[model samples]
Target: MDNIYIYMLIALAFLAVADLVVGVSNDAVNFLNSAIGSKAISFKTIMIVASLGVALGALSSSGMMEVARKGIFNPGEFMFDEIMIIFTAVMITDILLLDFFNTLGLPTSTTVSIVFELLGASVCIAILKISADDSQSLLHLGEYINNSKALEIILGILLSVVIAFSIGAIIQFFARLLLSFNFQNKPSWYGAIFSGIAVSSILYFILVKGVKNATFMPDTLKDLVSSSPFQVIGVSFLLFTVISYLIIKFTKNNIYTIIIIIGTFALAVAFAGNDLVNFIGVPIAAFNSYEAWSASGVLPSNYAMVALNQPVGTKPILLLIAGLIMVLTLWFSSKAKAVVKTSVDLSRQDNVKERFEPNFLSRSIVRLSMTASEKFNSLLTPGSKRFIDKQFAKPVQALKTKSEDMPAFDLVRAAVNLMVASILISLATSMKLPLSTTYVTFMVAMGTSLADRAWGSESAVYRVAGVLNVIGGWFFTALSAFVAAAIMAIVLYYGRVYALTGLLILAIVLLIKNYLSHKKQSREQKEADSLERSESSSTQGVIIESAKNISNVVKRGNKIYSSAINGLATQDLKALKKNKKNITKLSNEIDDLRDNIFYFIKNLEEPSLAASNFYINILSFLQDMAQSLDYISSVSYKHIHNNHKKLKFTQIKELQEIDAVMETLFGDIKSAFASNSFTEIGTILAEKKSIINLVTEKIQKQVERTRSEESSPKNTTLYFSMLLETKDLLNATMNLLEEYHSAHDEKVAPARLPGSADPSLEEE
Candidate 1:
C-alpha cells in the first residue's frame, strides 16, 4: 500500500521531466522569434543567451512554486489521495496538450493550459467531495475552492491577447514614427536613446517580475530595488545609454543587435522564472504531500494534505535540473523550429505566400481597414500627408536587403516587440496574474508587424487570418484543458493506478506517434525540394524546369486518379482518404508555385519577362491537372465515408475500363513531360478521343441501368459521376500535353496556355 502511492509520486517526477521538455519546445518560440526574425545575431548565439537566462531564472524562481500548489484551489480541503490525483491529472493533460500544439506547429498558451487543468481537476474532485459527503450541501462548496483567484486567471487569459496587441501597436506606431524604416542611418545618439528606453524597461521588468521571487537575494538590496524603482530606471537608462553610445562610437556594433540579444535573455529568464512553476510545481507539491503522508503514519486516503497551503519552497537543485532540461530542449528540439516558423511567417515583411489561407472574415476585415485608411488619408492636410508619406517611405537599401534576406522585420521593430512583450508579461507577473507568455509574445509580434507595415496590403488578409486562427486556438486550448482535465480527474479518482497505467502508456504512444509523423513529413518535404529544378533564366531552363514540374505533377496525378477509381471499386476508404490528403498537399504546392510567379519574374533578368508569361501558363496548366485529381479523390472518399452503397458490379466493370484508359493517358503524358518531347503526345491526344467515347458509353449504360436495372440511387449516381469526371480529366490531361507540345513548337511562346479550363474540374 505504501509502495503504491510512492510509485505514483515517482511517476510524477518522471512526468515533470517530460513536461519540461515539451513545454520548452512549445514555448521556445515565445522568446526566440524576435531575435531570429530580425537576424540580428546568429541562432547559436541567441540560444546561448536564452540558455543562460533560463539557468539564472530557475535559480531565482523559488517563490513562484506556490501557484501550482494553492493558487487554483485550497489544498486543505482535500485528502492527500485526492490532491495527488488532481496533480496527476493536470500534469498529464498539460504535457499532452502542449505537445499536441507543438506538433501542429502553432504556439498556444501553456499558462492557460496549466491553470485551466488545475481549475477543471479541482472542480471535478470538488464535485465528488460534495456528492460523497451527504451532509455537506452544494452551498458549502465555496469553502473547497478559491473562486476569486481562478476568475483572475481566466480573466488574465483574455486580457493578455488584447492588452499585448494594443500596447505593442501603440509602442511600435510611435517607435516607427521616430526611427522610420531607415533607422540604421540615424545618428548614434538617436539609436542610443531608443536602446536606453528599451533596456531600462526590460531591466525593470526582469528585476521586478523575475527576481522579486528570489529567496537568496539580500534583503537590503531587494528592498532598495523594489522601493526606489524610478531611481533604478534612471540609472539603467543612463547606464545602457552610455554603454550603447560607447559601443556605437568605438566599434562597428549595432545597437539593435545589443538590444535583441539582451531582450532574448530577459524574456527567456522571465519565462523560466514564471512558467517553470506550471511544470514542476505540481510534482513538487505531490512530493511534499507524500512526505507529509509518510511522517503521519496514516493511509494515503485518510491523510489530509494541509501542508500544501503552507508556503513550501522549491529546492534550488530541482530548479537547476528543470532549467537544464529547458536549455537542452532549446538547443535540439526540431519542433521548436516548426513553431518558430509560424511566428516568423505571420510577421514577415515581404509579400510571400502564407501557409494558412485568407478566409471570408479576414477578407472583410482587410477590406474595411483599407476603406477606412483611404478615408483617413483624404482628411489629412496636403502638407501633413506629404510629410507623413516621407516619414513612411522606405530607404532603397532596406528594400534591396529585404529581397535578399529572410528577416521578418527590421531590428528596430524586433527590439520594440521584445521590449513591449517582456514589459507586459513581467508586469502581469509582478501583479500575480498568470499572463500567457505565448499570447503576449505572439500577439505582440503581430501587433508590431501591423504598425511597422510588415502586414502589407498584398498579404494582410492572409496574415490577419493566420493570427486569428492562432488566437482561436488559444481559446480552444482553455476549453480542451478544462474538459480533458476534468474527465481525467474523474478517471483517476475512481480508477486509481489502473487508470494511471493506461493513461501514461497512452501518453507515451501519442508522443512517439507525433514524433514519427513529424519526421516522415520533414523527410518528404526535403525530398520534394531536392527534386525541384532551379528557376528558369533562359528559354532552355524554362523548358527544362517546367518539364520537371510537369512530370512530378503527372506522377502524383496518376496515383490520385488510380486511387479514386480503385477505392470506389473496392470500397477502400483508407486509400481514398490518403489520396484526398495527397491531392490537397499537391494543390497547395502548385498554389505556392503559382504565387511565386511574382518573385520569379522579379528575379528574371531584363528581356526575359516573356519567360514569365510562359512560366505562368505552364503553372496554370499543371494546377488544372492537380485540381482534376483532387476533385475525383475528394468525391470518392466522401461517397465511401458516408457509407453509400458501393457501385454495382457492372458499374465497377465500366469504371475499371475508364480507369485503364486514364492510366494509359497518365503514362504517355508523363513520358512526354519527362523527356520534354511531344512525339508521343499525338498518340495521347488520339487516345483522349477514344477515352471520352468510352466514358460516354459508360455513362449511357449507367443511364440505361438507372432507368431499369439500377437498384441503388447512390450506386448509379456514383458510377455516372466517375465516368463523366474521367472524361473531363481526360480533356484537361490532353489539353495540358498539347500546350507543352506548343511550348516545344515555339521555344518562347506567348503568355497564354492553349488549354481551356476543364469544366469538369469544378467542384460539384
Candidate 2:
C-alpha cells in the first residue's frame, strides 16, 4: 500500500505534463488568434513575442496554485488518500477533455474544466464520506465544499463571456469610427493617441496586474503597486504617448501593428499566468499532501490533508519546466494551429469558406439585427448616414485581393480584440478569479468582427452560427467535466491501484486514437484527389486548370460508380456506406468549384472572357456527374442499410456488366483529360452512344424481368433507378468531353495542339 502511493505520485507527474500539452494546445488560440488574424507582423516575430509572454506568465502563476488546492473544496475535510484520488481524477479528466476539444479544433475553457473537475471530484469524495458517517447527511456536504468560492469562479467565468463581448464591441465600434478603414492616412496625432491608449493599457496590466502574482517578486514592489496603481497608469500613459508620437513621425510603420504585437504578448502572458493552475496545480497540491503525510508518519487514510488548505509556493524550477513544455507545445502543435484557424475563419473580413452552416437560431438573429439596423437608420439624417457609411467602407484594393493574401481583418480591429481581451483577462487574474481566457479572447474577437462589419449579409448568419456553436461547446465543457470527473473519482476511490492503472491505460489509448485519427484526416485532406478552383486569367490557363480538375473528377467518379454497383451486387452495407462518404466528398469538391465561379469569372482577362463560358459549362457537366454518383451511392447504401432484399444473381450480373463497360469508358476519359489529349476526347465522345445503348438495354431487360420473373418491387425499383441514373451519368460525361473538344478546336487549329499559340486564335 505504501509503494502504491509512490506509483500514484509518478502517475500524477506524468498526467500533469500531459495536461499542460493539451491545455496549451486549446488555449493557444486565446493569445495567437488576434496577431495571426491581423497578419500585421511576420509569423516568426509574433510567435517569438508570444513565446516570451508565455514563459514569463508561467513563472508568475505560483500564487494561482492555491486555487486547485482549497479554492473549490475544503481540503482539511478529506484524508490524504481521498485527496489523492480526487487529484488523480481531476488530472485524468482534464487531459482527456482538453485533448478532445483540441482534436475537434474548437477552443474551450481550461479554467472551467479544471474548476469543475475539482468541484466534481471533491463532491464525489465528500458524498462517500457523508455516507460512511451516519451523523452527517447529504446537506452537510457544504462542510466539505467551498461553495462561495466555487460559485464565484463559475459565475465569473460565465459572466466574462458577456462582459468581454460587450466591451469589445463598444471599443471596436468607436475605434473603427475614429480611424476608419484607411487609418494609415490619418494624422500622426490620431495614430499616436490610439497607440498611447493601447500601449498604456497593455503595459499597466503586464507590469502591475501580471507581476503582482509572481513568486519571485519582492514584497516592496507588490506593495507599491498595491498602493498607487493609478499613479503607475498615468506615468505609463504619458511616457508611451510620447514614444508613440516619435515612432509615428520618425518611422513609416503602422501604430495598429505595434498594438497588435503588444496585445498578443499581453494575452499570452495573461493566459499562462492565470490558466497554469488548471494544468499543474492539482499535482503540486497532491505532492504537498504526500509530504505532509510522510513527515507525520501517519496512515494515508487517517492523515487529514490539513497542509493543502494553506497557501504554498511552487518551486520555481517546476514552473520553469512547465513553462518550457508550454512554449514547445505553442510552437510545434498542429492542433494549436487548427484551433486558431477556427477563430480566424469566423472573424475574417472578406467572404471566404465558412466551416459552419447557418442554423435557424443564427438566421433569426441576423434577421432581427437587420430589422433593428433599418429602424435605427431611419432616425439619422442623410448627411450623418453618408458620413457613417463612408467611415465603414472597405478599401477597393482589399476587396480585389485574393482572400489568402488578405488579412482576416485590419490592424485596428485586431488591436481592439487584443486590448479588450487583455484588460478582461488581466482584471480577472488580479482578482484571482480564474476567468476563462478562451471565453474572453474568443468572444472579444467575435464582437470586434461584428463591429468592424466583417460579418456581411452574405456571411453574417454563418458566422453567427459558428459563434453560437463555440458558446454551446463552452457550456458543454462545464457539464461534461463535472460528470466525468465525478465518475472517475468514484472509480479511483474504490478500485484504488487497479482503477488508476486502468484509467492511465485508457487515457493513453484514447490519446493515441485521437492522434492517429487526426493524422489520418490530415493526410487524406492533403493527398485526396480534390478539385481546385481556377486562378487563371487566360483561355489556355483555364484549360490547363480545368483539365486537371476534370481528370480528378473522372478518376474519383469511376471509383464511386463502381463501388455502388459492386455494393449492390454483394449487398455489403459497410462498403456501400463508405462508398457514399467518398462520393459525398467528391460532390462537395464539385460544389466548392461551383462556388468559386464568381472569383473565376472576376479573374478572367478581357481577351479570354470567352473562357468563362467554357469553364462554366465544364463545371455544370461536372456537377451533373457528381449528382448522378451521389444518387447512385445514396440508394445503394440505403437499400443495404435498410435490410432490403438483395438483388437476384441475374440482376447483379447485368449491373456488373454495365459497371465493366462504364469503367473502360471512364478510364479513357480520365486518360484523355489527364494527358491533356483533347483529340482523344473525340473518340470517347463517339463511343458515348454505345454506352447509352448499353444502359438502355439494361433498363429494357430489367423491365422484362419485372413483368415476368422479378418477385421484389424494391429490387425492380432499385434496378430501374440505377439504369436511368447511369444513363444520365454517361450523358453528362459525354457532354463534358464534347464541350472540351469543341472549345479546343475553336481555340487551336486542327494542325496544332490545344494550347499552341496561333496568330488567328489571338483576339489581338
Candidate 3:
C-alpha cells in the first residue's frame, strides 16, 4: 500500500516528460506562427532562435508550480493519499488533452486546460469527502475547494479574447494605413517609426513578462520592480526606441527583419516563462507533497498536505531539462509544422483555397460585415472614401522570389503581431493577471488579418469559420479537460492500482497511434504531389492528362467502395478509416486540379482553350465521384464506430454483389479512358446503370424490411445511405466517360477559329 505513493511519484515524473512534448507541440503555434508566416528568417534560423528563447524562458520562469499545489483546491484539507491521487489524475488528463488537441492541429490554452483540470479533479474529491463525512456539508465545499480562484482565472481568459481581438484590429489598421502595402517606396522615417514602436513593445514584454518570474532574480531587483514599475518600463522603452531610430539612420537595413527576430525571441521567452506550469507544474507539486509527507514521519493517509498552500521553488536544473525537451520537440516534431500551417492558412494574403468549409454562421457574419462597410463608405465624403480605399488596396504586383515559399504576411505585420501580442501578455503578467498567451496571440494574428483585408470576399467566410472553429476548440478544451480530469480522479481514488495501470497504458497507446497516423499522413501527402502534373499544352496533351486523372478516379473509387463494404461487413473500422483518408486525398487532388484551371488555360495554345473547357468538365465529374466515395466510407465508419446494429446478412450479401458490379464497371471505364477510345463507353454506361438498379433494389428491400422486420433506425439509414451514395458514384464515373468521348470527337472549323469554339458550332 505504501508502495503505491512511490509508484505514483514515479509516474508523475514520467508524465511530465510526455506532457512537455505534447504541450510544446500545441503551444508552438503561438510563438512560431508569426515567424513562420513572415518567412523573415530561414526555417533553421527561426527554430534556433525560438529554441533559445524557450530555454532561457524556462530558466527564468517564476515556477508557477504553486498553482498546481493549491491554486484550485484547499490542499491543506486533503491527506497525502488524496493529494497524490488528485495530482496524478491531473498529470494524466493534461497530457492526454494537450496531445489530443495537437493531433488535431488546434491551438488551445494550456492555462485553461491545467486550471480547469485541477479545479475538476479537486472538485470531484471534495464532493466525495463531503458525502462520506457527516460533519462536512455540501454547503461547506468552499472550505475544501478554491472555486473563487478558478472562476477568476476563467473570467480573465474570457476577457483577454475580446481585448486582444479589438486592440489587434485597431492597431493593425492604423499600422497598415501609415505604411501601406507597398510601403517600400515610402520614406525611411515611416519604417523607422513602425520599427521603433514594435521594438519598444517587445522590449516591454521581455522585462515585464519574461524576467519577472526568473528564479535567479535578486530579491533587491524584485523589490525595485515592485517599488517603481513605471520607471523601469519607461527606461526600457526609451532604450529600445533609441536603438530602433539609430538602426534606421545608420544602416540601409531591413529593419522589419530585425523586429521580427527580436519579437519572436520575446514571445518564445514569454511562453516558457509564463506557460511552463501547464506542463510540469503538477508533477513538481506531487514531488513536493511526497517530500512533505516523508518529513512528517506518519502514515500516508494520516499526514496532511498543508505545506502545499505555500510557494515552493522549482529546481532550475529541472526547468532546464524540460526546456531542452521542448526545444527538441520544436526541432523534430512533425506536428509543429501542421499547427503552424493551420495558423498561416487562415491569415495568408494570397488567393489560396481555404481548408475549412464555410457554415451559415460564418457566412452570415461576413455578410453583415460587408453591409456595415458599405454603409460606412456611403457616409464618408467622396474624397475621404477614395483616400481610405487606396490605403486598403492590394498592390498591383508584389516583390517576388519564391511566392510558394513566401510567408503568409510580410515582415511588417509579422513584427506587429509578435510585438503587440507580447506587450499585451507582458502587461497582464506584470499586473499579476492571468492572460492566455495562446488566445491573445492567435486572436491578434486574426485581427490583423482582417485589417489587412486578407479575408477578402472570396475567403472571408472560410477565414471566419476557421477562427470560430479554433475558438470553439478552446472552449472544448476547458470542458473536456475538466470532465476528463474529474473522471480520472474518481477512478484513481477507488480503483487506485488498476486505474493507474489502465490510464498509463491508454495514454501510451493514444500517443503511438497519433504519431504513426501523423507520419503516414505526411508520406501520403508527398506521394499525392509526386505524381506527374497533368500538363495540357495542346488538345492532345489535354486528352492524355484527362485520361490519366480519369483512370486514377476509377481505380481509387473502386478500391474505396470495396473497402467500405468489406470493412462494414467485418466491422473493421481501422480499414474503413484508412479508406476514408484515401478518399479525402483524392478529393483534395481534384480540388487542386480545379484551382489550376487558370494556369492550365494560360498554358494552352490560342486555338486549344477548348482543351481547358474539356479539362474542367473532366475534373468536375472526378471531384463528384471522389465526394460520393467520401460520404460512403465516412458514414460507414461512423455507423460501425457507434456500435450500431450491423446490417442484416442478406443486406451484406447484396452489397457484396453491388461491389463486384461496380468493380467491373470501373475497370471498363479505366480501359476506355486509358485508350482514349471510349469504344467501350456504351458497355461501361450499361454496367453503371445495372449496378445502380441492383443497389436500388437492395434499398427498396431494406425499406420494406424496416416497415415489417427491421427496427433499428440507424441500421436502416446506414444501409440506405451507402446504396444511394454508391448510385451517385456510379453515375459520376459514367458521366466522365461520356464527357471524354465528346472531347475526343469534337472538331472546330478552322476558318473562323476562336480560342474556344462551342461544340454546337463545331463541324461534324
Candidate 4:
C-alpha cells in the first residue's frame, strides 16, 4: 500500500512536469516574436531568458494556485474523481490546442483555452453527477448556469484584447515621440537607464501587481522576503536597478532592449506558473486523492473519492519538477519548428512543382471564421462600422506606424489603453466574463499599427481591418475547448476510459514521428554535403586557371592596353544582360552553397588555408563584379542618347558593343548566383571588372574630346540629363543590389545560419 501511494505520487509528479513543459512551449511564441523583431536579443539568448523566466515564475506561483483551486467551478458540486477527470481533460486538450497554434506561429490565449476546457468538463461532470444522483434534480440547470464562472471568463477574454491593444499603441506612441526629439543624436546611457527603470518599474507594478493573482511574488516569498508591499517593491526595485546599471556599464548594451527582453521573459514565466494549475491542477489534486484513498485501504464506494489539498511543502517540489519538464518540452518544440521549415522548403522544391498548400484543417478553419465574422458584423448597428472606422480604425491605423521600431509610449495612448483595459477587465471581473490577453495585446498592436499607419499606405488599412476582424475567431478557442471537454467527459463516464493509455498512445505517436523526421533530415543533410564537396573539387582547377589568366591580362595591359581592355570588355557586357533575368532565382542556390561551405570548412581535418583563401577570393570577386556593373551603367547612358558631341558613329558602335559585353558579364554573375557556384563567381567577377575599367576609360576619353570641342547648349543640356539619369539609376541599382547582396551574405556566412556548427553563427 505504501509503495502504491509512492508510485501514484511519482506519476502525479511526472504529469505536473508534462503540464509545465507544454505550457512553456506553447506560451513562448507569444513574446518570442516581439523580442526577435525588435532585435532586442538573439533567438538563442531570448530562449535562455525565457527559460529563466519560467523558472522564476514557477517558484513564485503559489498565489495563483488559490485561483486555480476555487476560481473556475464549485468544488462541492462534483466528487473528487469527477473533478480530477475534468482537470485531466482540460490539461490534455489545452496542451494539444496551444501547441497546434504555436506550430502555426499564431499567438492564442492560454487563459481562454483553460477557461473553456474547464467549463466544458465541469458541465459534463455536473450533468453526469446530477443524473446519477436523483436527489440533486431540484437544483435546476439555470441555477448551475447562473452560478457558473463562464461569464466572467468570457468577458475577461474579450476585454483583454481591447485593453492590451490600446495600451501597446499608446505606450509605443510616446516612446516614438521621445525618440524623435533626439533625431540628430542618439540617447545617452543615462537616458536609457532612466527609461529602462521607469518602464520596467511600471510594468512590474501594473502587470505583476494589478493582475490579481500574478505570481511574480508569491505569498510565501512576500512573507519570507518582507512584511510590507512597499518593502518588497523597494527591495526588488533596488536590486533590479543595480543589476541594470552593471549590465549597461560592462556590456554597453541598450538598456531599453534589455528591459523589454527581461520584461517579456518575466511575463512569459508568470504566465506559465499561474496557468499551469489551470491546465494540470485538478489532475494532480485527483491523483493525490486517489493516493490518499488507496493508502486508507478503501475499495469501491461511490464514484466520489476523498478530496486532498496539496501539502504546502509539496507545492514547491511539484512546481520545480513541472518547470524542468516544461524546459524539455520547449526544446522539443524548437525541433518541431525546424521540421516545419524543412517541410516548407520541400513543398517548394522545383521537382515537385506543386503550389505550396496549408493543411485542409487550417484552410477550413480560416474560411469558417471569416464567414462567421462577416455575419456578426452585418447584425450589428448600422453605424457600428462607421463608429469602428472613426474611433478605433483610424486612430489604430495611425498608431501602428508610430509604434514601429519600438516607439516610446505616449501618455495619451497609454491613458486610453489603460482606461479601456481597466474598464473592460473590471466589468468582466464584475460580470464574470472570460477574455483573452493575447486577443487584447494583439488587437492593441493592430489598433496601434493602424493608428500609426505602420502599413505605410491606406490600402493596407482594410487588410488590417480584416485581421482585426479575425479577433472574433479567438472566441472559437474557448468554444472548441468547451465542446472537446464535454465530449471527453462523456467518454470518461460511459466508455472504458484509460487515462494513462490515452497519454501513452499520444506520447508514442509524437516520439516516433519526431525520431523519423530527425533521421531523414540527417540523411538529406549528408547527401547535400557530399554533392557540394564534389562540385567544389571539380570547380577548383577551373577557378585557378581563370585567376592566372586574369593576372596575365593585368600584367600585359601597360602597353597596347586598349586592345586587351576591349577584348575583356566585350566578354563582360554580354554576360550581364544574359543573367539579369536569373538574379532572383538564386535564393535557394545561395542557401545551399552557404550550408555546404560551412560544413566543409568546419569539418576540415588539416589546416586548409588554400580552401579558406579560395572562398575569400570568390567573395571579393563577387563584390568587384557588383562595382563594375555600377560603373558600366553610369558610362553606357551617354551612348543610349547619342549625346557625345565629338564621338563618331564608329565610337558609338564600339560603346554599344561594350554595353553588350556588360550585359554578358551580368548574365554570368546571375548564373553563378543561381547555381551556388562560389568557386566560379570570382573568375566571372574578374572578367566583369576588366570590362568595367575598359568602358570607364572609353567614356573618360569621350568626355575629354567633347570638352576640347565647342560646348553647345544642346550638348550641355544632354550631358546634364545623362548625368542625372546616371545618378538615379546608380542609386536605384545600388540599393537593390545591396539588399540582394546582404541577404545572400547572410545565407552563405556560416555564423548567420541558425543552429549551424560555427561558433560565430551561434552568436547574435
Candidate maximizing TM-score? 2
Per-candidate TM vs. native? Answer: 0.88, 0.96, 0.81, 0.52
* Model 2 TM-score relative to the real fold: 0.96
Clashing pairs in 1: none
How many residue-pair clashes does candidate 4 contain?
Answer: 76
List, residue by residue over 1-764, the lDDT tens digit for candidate 2. Answer: 77888988999999999999999999999889988888999989989999999999988875436778888888889999999999999999999999999999999999888889988999999999999999999999999999998778778877888898889988998998899999999899888888888888887777655666786789987776667767777887788888899999998777888898888888788778867878888898888888999999889989988888778888888889999999999998888988999999999998877889999999999999999989999999999899888999988766433646668888888888887876776666666675777898899999999988889998999999999999999989989999999999999999999999999999999999998998887787787486777878878777777888999998899999999988888888889989988988888878878877777777668875689899999999999999999999998998999899999888899899989998899888888777676767776788877778888988888888778888998888888889899998988988888889888787766565543344443332
Worst 10 residues of 4 by lDDT: 345-354
In candidate 2, what residue range of length 10 has the lowest lDDT sum? 755-764
* Residue 324 Cα positional deviation in candidate 4, in Å, after optimal superposition: 2.0
Candidate 3 similarity to native, TM-score: 0.81
**Cα lDDT computed for each candidate against the true fold:** 0.82, 0.86, 0.82, 0.47
For 470-490, candidate 3 gives per-residue lDDT tens digits of: 999999989998899999999
1-764 per-residue lDDT for model 4 (tens digits): 24433443454455445555545655554444344434446657877876776676556555334334445666544554555566666665666666555444345667777777777877787777677777777455543333446676566565566666666556544544444323214435443444444444544433442333434436775364334545554666666667666776688765666555655564555555556565556556656566555565544233344243334223566667666766666556654343223222221101111123344544554567468758978898978666544432222332212211332222223222322333333334334445444564345545554344343332243333334334544666778888977876676555424643465367447645645665565565444212122123222332332232222212221111222223223434444332332222222333333334543454333455555545544433433333333343334333333434443444545545654554454455444433334334435534544554665665575577578863565444433343343333234333333433443344454333221233322232
Which model scores highest in lDDT? 2
Give Cα distance to truth, residue 564, candidate 4, Å. 50
Q: Which stretches of candidate 2 lie over 4 Å from their true place?
A: 215-221, 431-434, 607-609, 750-764
TM-score result, candidate 4 = 0.52
